[model samples]
Target: MASDMPNWFAILQAQSYSAGGTVPLQCETSATYIAKVIRKVQNQGYAFISPSHEATADFNDVVSRFFDDKVLSESCNSWVKMGPGRSRNLVWWPGTAHRMEISRDPRWEDFVFGRAKETRVNRVAYFGNGWTERERVGGVESITNYLKEAGKGDLATLHEAWNE
Candidate 1:
């Protein structure tokens, strides 16, 4: 595991917005932006770790090293609350046509460190005014999949987007 939080975390979070359904075309563009961030991180070698014995241990370790318990509280934010009982969503915005969250019991670790396997994290289409109701974005996999065919120049754009 990484000894410290990656510098990109703040950059991405700064660019992230919590209110969904307000900005024009935010859903798709935000997804693209977040996917670019995820792809950038993956390029650095981290994988998405779903909830499990392994995830628990990893979450504990990451929190111990990175999260400040004093700063985190039971979030009443609808975005934070809209997920599996145990899992937590971090990068999602209404525009991306997807609902992405850590695939485990609610914890803030993945919010900071990301996860273990590329697919270990959960990604699904979201509908309505961002109430966490899931609808399908047919034939689409994760948002990151959108970049699978991206060329070097495309990646360079993403690097610029994330200041990488």
Candidate 2:
């Protein structure tokens, strides 16, 4: 079966839209599909996997612009806009947390575009943080539980208190 990540992402995005907020996910965390594929193409000799040259270039450009946008306050470790009526700076990094945006941090390039030395690829691609299996799995379960309960509780109370 195909991975459920995409469906999970769609559900989260839909919730954000309904609540008048941006998706409550870090860009790198949620967009790991490309990163995983890139890693596979490099490590597994998946020559059939190819992103058009133009598409790759455009993605790099977009990353550059995201870092350049001061208003958005993006960085290698930054929270995106969360649910409506919630602090835009709030995020879940193992738990409720906040990060300071480091303007044009060089690590952002490495985090987003660098490959490990062992990889076959001689080019930059998506590289997110190193997450242990327990952290990744537990985090997802935690969020799912929170969403299920909060969705029920918030609707009952007619207020959004999920982030509280």
Candidate 3:
């Protein structure tokens, strides 16, 4: 006998917003979904543990683009000391809330491409910011709560919320 694996829908719903307008998620691509799922998995204390070169490259490229586009300007000054062989896994530390790392795995490409449809579906399921303020007020509390909950797990949550 084997224990049942967790359902992605259950996991996602558990992390869904408690209070917000009912806006539907809409992911634009499979790659985006894959990234979000990866973030969620990472947030759960599970390493992405990729098994293919292509997956590793995909992860790296997406991460690089995310940091370069969104984080570089505001948080570039902080430096995180790296071990001799840890350069590849290091990125700028954003105070105590955000940390980024990258590692290589030869098997991720296989997993990603092999389950392309699943990836696309997840990407679609986990898209968009589900909340907005009436007068343009930022939902900082909501956002922080979401991040704190998601960050407690793995990178999968981060990826899922990347576009949000």
**How many clashes (backbone N, Cα, C below 3 Å) per candidate?**
15, 0, 27
**Rank by lDDT (best first):** 1, 2, 3
Which prediction has the highest lDDT against the true structure? 1
| TM-score quality measure for candidate 2 | 0.20
Model 1 — which ten-residue stretch has the worst lDDT? 96-105
Candidate 2 — number of clashing residue pairs?
Answer: 0
lDDT of 3 by residue, 1-164 (tens): 00122212221221121112122321122223445556555433342333345544555565455445443334434333123422322443222222111212212334422223334445443333454442237555544544556437467666645435
Query: What is the lDDT, from 0 to 100, of the residue 2 in candidate 2?
Result: 15
Write candidate 1's Cα lDDT for 100-137 as tens digits: 33211234343444444543443211122443212245
**What are the models' TM-scores?**
0.22, 0.20, 0.22
Query: Model 2: runs farther than 4 Å from truth?
Result: 1-47, 71-164
